[model samples]
Target: MSTIVRVAARGDGVAEDGRHAPFAAPGDTLTEAGEIIPGPHHQPPPCRHFPQCGGCQLQHLDDESYAAFVADRIATALAAQSIDAPLRPTALSPPRTRRRATLHAERGLVGFTAEGSHAIVDMRECHVLHPALFALVAPLRALLQRLRPKGRAELHLTLADQGVDLLIRGRLPDGLAAAEALTGFAQAHALARIAVDDGYGPETRWEPQPVAVTFAGTPVPLPPAAFLQATAEGEAALVAAVREAAEGAATIADLFAGLGTFALALPGRVYAGEGARDALLALKAAAALARRPVVTEHRDLFRRPLTTAELDRFDAIVLDPPRAGAREQVAQLAASKVARLAYVSCNPSSFARDTATLCEGGWRLDWVQPVGQFRWSTHVELAAALSR
Candidate 1:
């Protein structure tokens, strides 16, 4: 008999001896034959799509097991680099908390892609999307049917402060006829804004008022398709962790800052550096409006990370990088004289790798906060504090 000990990184359950069992959860029992016996941690999935949706894989596991899986992923990555730190209990956003999602449309169906296939799930029900976002599905389907689109298209939905922001890709919205259709759709839905792109770039179709995203109690212009944290609760959790790490610093540097998520929130002179022009401009405008002491810079950190000598000017540093992680920047930071460092990451493996670089430079992990932003999915996020 093989006992499933825990869930692996890709949503598979691992046996005590490290064998693989598909769709098995922790505490499950397997017999001599290849069969997954239900376990205490396993439960019926709530969403009708379940394994077919590809939006969520761990829906079969209960809350405890799911949260455990999130923490274990971070631990496993840290252990790879011989790093250990006390981790807070995983903070999980509840179902229907997702504020941003990309849905595929094909064969007159609109929803998430089918598991391991290009086929569309045609979402009649979704437990992952916010109710407001989900409510747009039926209307979207009707619009697509009426248009009779020739091929594949993608829909990106984001909940801005004003209302839902919709961006459609892979369809031609040219001509007076198509323009009228989109205008009617936007007005009917009372959407905050609608954008259409045909492999070139997003062009705004309709926007009545300026759409913005309130971060850390300040309203910042929400640039079209700008990067945003997926869930509101998840963003709050990460912000809290960042604040704790950044406490007591009179001057803090926010590396890779996106629209001042932390720069505007941190209570000090903030130096925000980002590569995207629009994001930098938005952060600058918000900082000016808030009258905060925030200095903005347009920098490509990947190509030109701040040097060690340049880094020593700040008391603390906060960097929230993309999935590829900030290896180059971490290397420079490792050799810097900066005292406190807070890192917010979406990829554990990359975070662990970069952390090893910092540890090698005599830095130590202070603490870790594991976050499950996208619930029931294998994706994991974390915020960590480090010191010399």
Candidate 2:
């Protein structure tokens, strides 16, 4: 008999009925309104490790109910701020939309750490990633198993729609041999590109080739570590929303512009700003090829901002900031009286706060279109338009 252990429920100290079967478990049963679904299926197996593993908490619920729970979470967060928006249907994305993951390496084990702690989870399969990654996992594990380096830290895996890029934290046997091995792995798997990060390792060598990704009918080359949306479909949806909002606008300012995803696609003259030097250069290259007149400025808007004089020249503005949201910067734009402002935010709470600010500044809140970029998690990416 498999020894079943009871795990504590999330936020509740008491363990609920959920079992941790070694390889597989029972399917979660669901109940209709005012009806009780009886039997062993209804009796959930309690997880013994639930309190510790931060990976998942809703494992006991069926897939449909689990999705509703996720929607409720976002709705609750937004409701707190008195913002009412339609609860958009949750989009089911690949389990491993995680383009980049940081893993801990200890005692020859390479895997993700348990949710709240630094302890490894010993992950065999990630349900969220593209299915192709499952076949590549064994080879990745074999490669890591062969490597042993002193003072080893963590491994970072970045997967794009095109290829996989790795950032290993310790020294390898030899640079030439390691590069040859990575290239061989790529060819064997039919990968588009590969990047090895030995920046923290001894005798590091950095040689990166652009990862090719098609966007808006153009092949844009992105650096290995560059920021791209985890899901290509999600990015396309966002691009469509942005283009729709900015159509026929004269001069536009793109804030927090990474690789000019929106700037390169816009119809008119674009003034783009990004903190990353490499992203700006790549965006410039893409613009040149597309014959789009884009003047990019590499500026950290968080530290030094776009001046009022700079804001006065643009007829429309588009902002896509980091997860922190662009509260301070959005406030600046609200004061500028730009004709139409489109704000794209990954965090809904901050988006609500910032959008409220714009509303108070005489700009009308037009619509908030939600995009499921990170499919499984509580995160939401929204593109909202405000017209004065």
Candidate 3:
């Protein structure tokens, strides 16, 4: 006996079967049609493995569709705070934006974990990596299997235009031999450089050569591990947006400035502050080389925040804080004599909190635009321009 049970439907069209009737689920494995059609703004179905793969949450849709989904999510978050501004919709350039990735090295095999599981998938090719590095996956995996020095370890691999870096983890049976194998692999593969972090003592310092990217007919050399936007196109757009907003502003303060991405791009003298000594040193030197006027100060803005007195030194400010927004600093900047403040943030929740504080402190939200830098993930970078 076959009995079909019908569940109550809402305006959203979601049914009890957890499927939408109008929109069929993406794969051929599904026997029933989904009740909810993927909306114009909804993420499309691409991979059968959706929400499971921690690697890419938005892989279910094509690049353009995915970018819209991300933009809408950012819009919804911002609108909750009464911020009604035009969103700059952008397309995602998929299939090669990932510069660094960590792979699990198992018994005689090396690969990434399967969707939703730590179980390693012995992958011959990764769709997320650049073609040059993607083509080397098999050979690199074979090299790991032959070396077989550690037990259930992970390989941290970073690729740039200059070379590749290999940071090995876990216990290795042979230390020196493992190093030799890695060195040999690099030489044979024409990998410009190779490094090993065998959990040996302190963290090894890897000063990678500058990676070159063209912007406005100028070649920008970014430090290897410094904070550059994930995608090349995204960085260009973000830099242009900031430059346009800050064209004639004199004396800018770049808070949470990692390698002076905004500070160096801006004209006139800029004061930059970051918590990391290495990043600040590299940024200061690079600024000098580029003939850009940027003075960097290594200070922990989190623990001890910048005072209003310090904020008064700059006529304008740009803040690119981490996931945790610069709450206190935003309030301080709002109270200071600074006329305009541009905030670039990745986390909307933190941005909302900080925006509320700033608004109360006398700053008005002028506009916000979403930057779809990290294409496949739920994370969206936002650039907000505020004024007094």
TM-score against truth, every candidate: 0.98, 0.77, 0.80
Worst 10 residues of 2 by lDDT: 6-15
Q: What tens-digit string does per-residue lDDT give for candidate 3 at 81-175?
A: 86655667664546677666777878766666765588777665455665665666788778767776656877666565566655566665556
* Models sorted by TM-score, best on top: 1, 3, 2
lDDT of 1 at 117: 89
lDDT of 1 by residue, 1-388 (tens): 8899999999999998778888899999877686889899999999889899889989989999999999999999999988899999999999999999999887679999877888888899998899889999999988877776668888999999989999988775457887898889999989999988877888888999988999878999988778889999999999999999999999999999989989988998999999999999999998899888999999999999999998999999998999999999999999999989999999999999999999999899999999998999999999999999
lDDT of 2 by residue, 1-388 (tens): 2222221212111112333322121232222232223223222424454424444444344445444544555565567777665644554444455555556666565565676677876656564554554456567667766655555546655565466655566555666776677667667776655545556422213333456555555566667556777676677767877887787898999999887778877878899999988778888787788777888899999887786667878988889998788877877877875778777777777777777777677777666566655543445676767788
Per-residue error for 77 in candidate 1, Å, reads 0.5
Best by TM-score: 1
Measured on C-alpha atoms, candidate 3 has an lDDT of 0.65
Which candidate should be chosen as best, given lDDT against the real structure? 1
For candidate 3, report its TM-score: 0.80
- Output the lDDT of residue 222, model 2: 66
